[model samples]
Target: MRRRDLLLLIGATAGATAMYQAMTRLGFAAESPYRGPITLEGDPKGASVIILGAGLAGMTAAYELARAGYKVQILEYNTRPGGRNWTIRGGDTYTELGGAAQQCLFDDGLYLNPGPWRIPYHHHAILDYCRRFGVALEPFIQLNHNAYLHATEAFGGRPQRIREIKADFEGAIAELLAKATRKGALDEAVSKEDQEILLEALRAQGGLDKDFRYKAGDDAADFRGYARDPGGGLAAAPSNGEPIGLHDLLTSRLWRGLQNFALYDFQTTMFQPVGGMGRIGEAFARQIPKVIRYGAKVTAIQQDDHGVAVVFEDLHGGGSVEEATADWCVCALPLSILSQIDVNVSAPMKAAIDAVPYASVVKTGLQFRRRFWEEDEQIFGGISYTNLPIRQISYPSTGFNAAGKGVLLGGYTWGGPNSYELTAMSPADRIKVALDCGAQIHPQYASEFETGISVAWHRVPFTLGCAGEWTDETRRQHYGNLCQIDGRIVLAGEHASYIPAWQEGAILSALDAITRLHKRILASR
Candidate 1:
């Protein structure tokens, strides 16, 4: 099998943790490259910079440039800051590309982050900024043992606990390995001493009995949970549940869900802002309040050897055309929207802008009358994987065991036919689909659902799609030209960095772009 196929097989059979380990050995997964906060060492001699968009990248560039003594101003299309770093709460209204306006009717304190939800610990730059800006963060639960893994064809379509699948799979594998070792099947491959050590390790890791058997007993119950709970009074002894046979377990294919939590990105210690992901953008905006010009849509980007001029329509001022000039420009607009604008840049740069495509994504936030997932299922904060079109349902990481009214990320569909299918529907129909699909995992979805909202990235007005989607061939052909400083105008955003589709990518790209721009400016003098 090919390496990719091998990894997929491991993920299907063993689990995602094993697959990640194999991938790490094969150089597929890596940590972030952010070192620390950047320092612009030299002055720009009072040079000015024009930053486009009010997203993290634009705001990051503005924040650092203004502190470095450059006169920095940002032109934003939206009335407020945080382009994709947005949050929708009650009383807010959103109009998509097709003029489909949805008013958020969520209860107060219940909101949805339509983009860039979790921040990995390895993403040092964003975390450092959050700390500096006083944006409190809470743990984002990626996996809960009590959460479910559901396959339509598995176990008669009943959901199984993540812990059950994980434990049973591990235990069964250990038993087979032990049987092989006892039969001297590894005599040529392993020394007797090493085999003994391996057996002991497997016994401990798999919660096996002394005979190396993975059967129903205290050892098995310790891992898979007891059939009957141990109480304080008579008949307090816990009863071990019957372990699923290896044949049945393999056929069920529930092990595929194990990969979701084992991937490097979804590992433990992920975090989200206390209020919403939008808090980070709001915090960045707080640092550079006067620098942003809201409701200004850029129509053309023109540049000369002397400076750069950006022509925009004053959205709030009767749509009148206006021009803003600066010594330099940082265009942080998403490529989906930028490719449609008239930009005066080199052929390579323009081609690079048009080369990248945006991903299709749909996220639906459903508010419930009660926290039924917690009250009835004992599932706190975690994700439930399914084979349904909705993909996965993520429970709120905040508000553990709270009383009434909670919001759930009912459905999040990333790329593929499902995302496009959901994108084609009206927002109301999308919500209905979410309710229908999610009900298979949580039956309470229909009754408990109060009101919901959905955001299809393709329909979003400001960003025609989600983050830039770059393929290997596209990156190899155009990534350099995309990041190269085109005269006085340069691009910065998640698309400009290796780590696309992440806020960290946007921050890192902005820092790198500004650092390079600062060097070129000082050299020019």
Candidate 2:
């Protein structure tokens, strides 16, 4: 949807609440860092820019600059468009760091987005790009009340429904607070008038009874769900499940994962491209195909006052070093790899390049013969968190209520010893570990599992690591140096933005970089 249409639709709404909801559903709820389509007001006078890495950041820069009448060329390390915005489907092959290649064995129409899987509602820059590129999107279910939260050491390795845990925890907290208020334990903290209002609010919020007790009854069932759902005729009456005691709930420590669903970033109205995350990159590729040269890996970068020159190897043909030069350069390459390259930049910029470390993450996708999680467990679309090395299992958000095969994100281990350990293992062993860990929560994994693929970000050749891990001190010291226009070269990518490891960050950083570059070009002319 265009900005004007979106504004008109929201303006036509009855109230702010309705407008907010409508804007969310239409993917225009948040204020974008991008002010609609960028228009480079001044001419570049045939200025040329060579962008490294054909990821979202580079493509975005190339797209905007080319439209603004600049000679734009994108040198990509991989043969495909999207860098981490990638997808693995049947018949596709991936080679990791150890020279081990794995061919995806997923069934047709099934795929795994090892990198960026969901677009948060607030990431308006990416959302706008998706809308403009005609990339179809579907709701990315962030929180499914039916999903499970399990810890092998807790609850005897059994998984609890998210709804039950959430309702019971809140209900228990409300009851305790209410009891304390009534007993005048909080007399000093809360006034009598406020105490009475608090008690009333707690009763309603916690599904408490007349005596303000959370127990097995219709009121509690309305929040925690029923032991047996209400039905027609003779069995119409609902049975309430007993609220878990505070002690048991606290000891389980499953409450730690519950807050994830409540975080503002993962709230409702998230989305993903209909087929895969790669659709975004492919769409961008369609707009500027000729300008992007795939399989061109940069080895050295040098910039003089006149222009910037990049030396790279043609990976597809024999590894012959080739040089590409332009009036300016936007190096979107990951800092992890860029730090190692021979780039002629100021000392601080080079130090800034090495200051930020890349994150390590491993993701495993398992294909099952049937939708057992949906049919047997009633888990439609959401993530099930666990303390195991596998971390989380996310059910596919697409293909809901459909009969046939299904794909599950069996494991996603981010950082720590687990990521390093998984990356060190062979692809088959990594898949095996994911299966073993997942089976602890979903026993059907042993039987229902058919084939799987795992991608360890550290092992990903295109990017040595997942994303730049910046600290407060690092950002304070080096962020400006890293982003500043160094001679005729500048940097742009997720690493350059405050919100790292997100597509929105990459696009925003690109937009910022290009805007500055365009200004410099106009001044030069």
Candidate 3:
């Protein structure tokens, strides 16, 4: 079966968490390979290079190349930096491809990151940049035991606490294993001594009683939580919560949500900028403000052995035609847009550009009158998974336990029929759908919702989609050509790296591309 079909099967049968695992295993995600700051040993001798797009990749190239004594200028389509590393704040406005515009009404200090938000500890390149630029970082909570996992048909559509499901599932599995071991079921696979040790370990792991049973008692309550409080005064005695039977737990399929917390990409120590994800882009733009020519949309790219010239329309200057010439070029534009622009390159490079498609995703941000998830539900941060078309709801990582209005990532859906369906609707309808679906998980959504804004990445005017959606077959066929320097121009972005859909990939791809370009330039001299 095709990769998408296989993933759909996994998602349908197993769940989103399982589908993500399969993606990672199939090379859809990978760790960054940044060791340290790159040093360009050779001099560029004032060689001029024009970079396309002022996103992370473009700015990273400009920063490094300018530091290496190269004259770098960047042309960006948007009037601001950070292509998809964006944040929507109060008073900010956005216009999609179909001319639907939205003016954000979030309160001060509240914003929504429609694109990349969290940075894993292992993404050293972005973290190094954040450190170098002095962008304040705070922990991004990916898993909160108090958060929820809901299946429409499970438990009469009632949501269950993550901690409850996790503890009960583990306890149930452990009890069964212990029973089998005690009945000599593992005698063929293990020695009697090892079997005894395993039984002891299982009891501790499952919070089972001395009788080797998982029951409603103090032992099980230790891991699964107590039904009543253990207070300092009278009536302080705690009561154990009943463990869900193994059959019910299995049938509920809530265990599918447990794997997400264990995924390497989303493990603890994840971080976001103190204010918003846009801070990283703002920091980069601050370093080289003069080099960026915002609102310049590339129309055509042509090159020869001597140098390269680019044709563009200055959207800020009455859409006048303009040209930029340089000795070299690092085109960091997204493939979704880049493929459509007239660019002179090898047939193979052009084919590579057209081969990769971008992923469709929709994210909706809702502002509420109060932080109900924190005030009422006590869910400070983290995500709640569901089988609904919205896929998941991620609570804000910042502004924990604050009093006034708050914004929640009310709905997030990856590439699927749901994403396309959401993308087809107007922004208003998307927000309404988000509110309706989210109300099922948190009934307070209907009452507390103030305003909301939704972004269907495919409808975005600039990127036209989310990140590059590469398959194993496409990567095998076109990834090499896409990265190769076609004459004086080379490509760099998340699309050119193994770790697609991440800032680290863009930075690393730029670093690698420019490093090779510098070497080639030095060799020519």
Candidate 4:
């Protein structure tokens, strides 16, 4: 049987609790940011809560609220859980705002996570939930030494290996600093004792030779890698790769991509769910299946001191308008969609809703005939950065070396005119752009392409656009209003957190919202 069918069979056969226990036994769980289970301390006296959107934030709140003795009911716009935490697999279909539908045609077990993909190790809340739900985790390689970095105008448009550029750049900087320090250029900035320590550190860190020079030699080759790799036999001597000169390396502008690898969030040891990021949502759904009302497009939100009432349309049932009311509400809807709704909040809150704008992102997933990136280019996993419109190409971290076929993130267009340009095109055209732009970095895309699916977040009906884009000025003026509970209702999601566009932001925002809401419940009683 295919892996997809096997996964389905397992899901059908196993209960949520049993599946979690099984995953625990298999060592699928990891250390988490959140401690153990949350304790609400006191009873809610059977309070009722109406949650908006069944995304991570909303579901997270519902899970904790239900456990704390609150009557929780969730209003979700989509037929499935995991709003932006979505995965596209073979046989799945997606329809955008322009009535353009794309059917995924990837092979069994292959998928495209059009939304959030990588999970940083520090995102404690989401990790804790994954541990609790038994969602399996696997390393998401963010910076692979073998990945490519290409600038369309540099090095004749040929790609350079990450290891080569990183090593060369470090070596060049070390040499420059050493030369300056020896010449007394930094006499005022450094003391004699510290200068000696700095020189020693640079020599070791930059892989410099006995003379502290980053030249083509065995020591240099060990760090940046070799032109001819060392083998196991007597004839296995390695040849050194020359360090890229300071001028050429600076002019190439390839060094700009290196900073992302050093970022606190994108650093090594990132993770993804075993199947897909949506497994987190699916697991959350299992805990509270009966509470969610799918296909409920909330049209208006009105809250009085007594309670909150939401007006919505049943999209699945002939678009009949209906109302749901609860003692309190947690609105996790995206600002892109919520801003248009007739929400009767305070003037400051309304302005805050309108103040933020959502970002535009287009992601395309391409299936290839085989794992040519691994076989041909030796790029097993990680992202390749380029100056092209596609921005970056990510190879799958799973199924390395032993693959009949594979899917890669062909293009992940985030913001700017390029994102808008791609968003305007049809789904097929978007895929074509991805193929054309990606060819500049990996020529194999021209021959090995099989099928593709593209998602332009601006054109997605459910989200209208990607996560909320906050500028310093906008956040200064509106962020407080957005997060503060407006009367009997509060808001939570990635938009409400500092770590925007991340699942951790959404989970953490939910936790904060519920904690405050619980306090209000106790104070009111």
Instruction: Using TM-score as the measure, name the better of candidate 3 and candidate 4.
Output: 3
List the lowest-lDDT window of 10 residues for candidate 1.
Answer: 27-36
- Per-residue lDDT tens digits of candidate 3, residues 1-525? 998788878976898888889988886664456888999988788899999999999999999999999999999999999999999999999999989999999989999999999999999999999999999999999999999999999999999999889989999889999999999999997899989899999999999999889999988988989888577778889888899999999999989988889998899989999989999999999999699998999999999989999999999899999999999999999999999999999999999999998999999999999999999988989999999988888998887887898999988999889999999999999999998889999999979999999999999999989999889999999999999988899999999998899899999999999999999999988
Worst 10 residues of 4 by lDDT: 25-34
Q: List candidate 1 segments past 4 Å from native.
A: 1-31
Sequence-dependent TM-score of model 1: 0.94
**Candidate 3 TM-score, true structure as reference:** 0.94
Model 4: residue 486 alpha-carbon error in angstroms: 1.3
What local distance difference test score does each model get? Answer: 0.93, 0.92, 0.93, 0.91
Q: Write the per-residue lDDT of candidate 2 for residues 220-310, one digit (tens) a residue.
A: 8988899899889986987778888889899999999998898878888899999999999999999996999988989999999899999
Runs in model 3 lying further than 4 Å from the true structure: 1-31
* lDDT (10s digit) by residue, model 4, range 424-453: 999999999999988888788889999999
Q: Regarding lDDT, does 2 or 3 come out ahead?
A: 3
Candidate 1 lDDT at 116 equals: 90
Question: Model 4 segments beyond 4 Å from truth?
Answer: 1-36
Using all chains and alpha carbons, the TM-scores for the candidates as numbered come to 0.94, 0.93, 0.94, 0.93
> What's every prediction's RMSD, in angstroms?
4.3, 6.4, 5.8, 11.2
TM-score of 2: 0.93
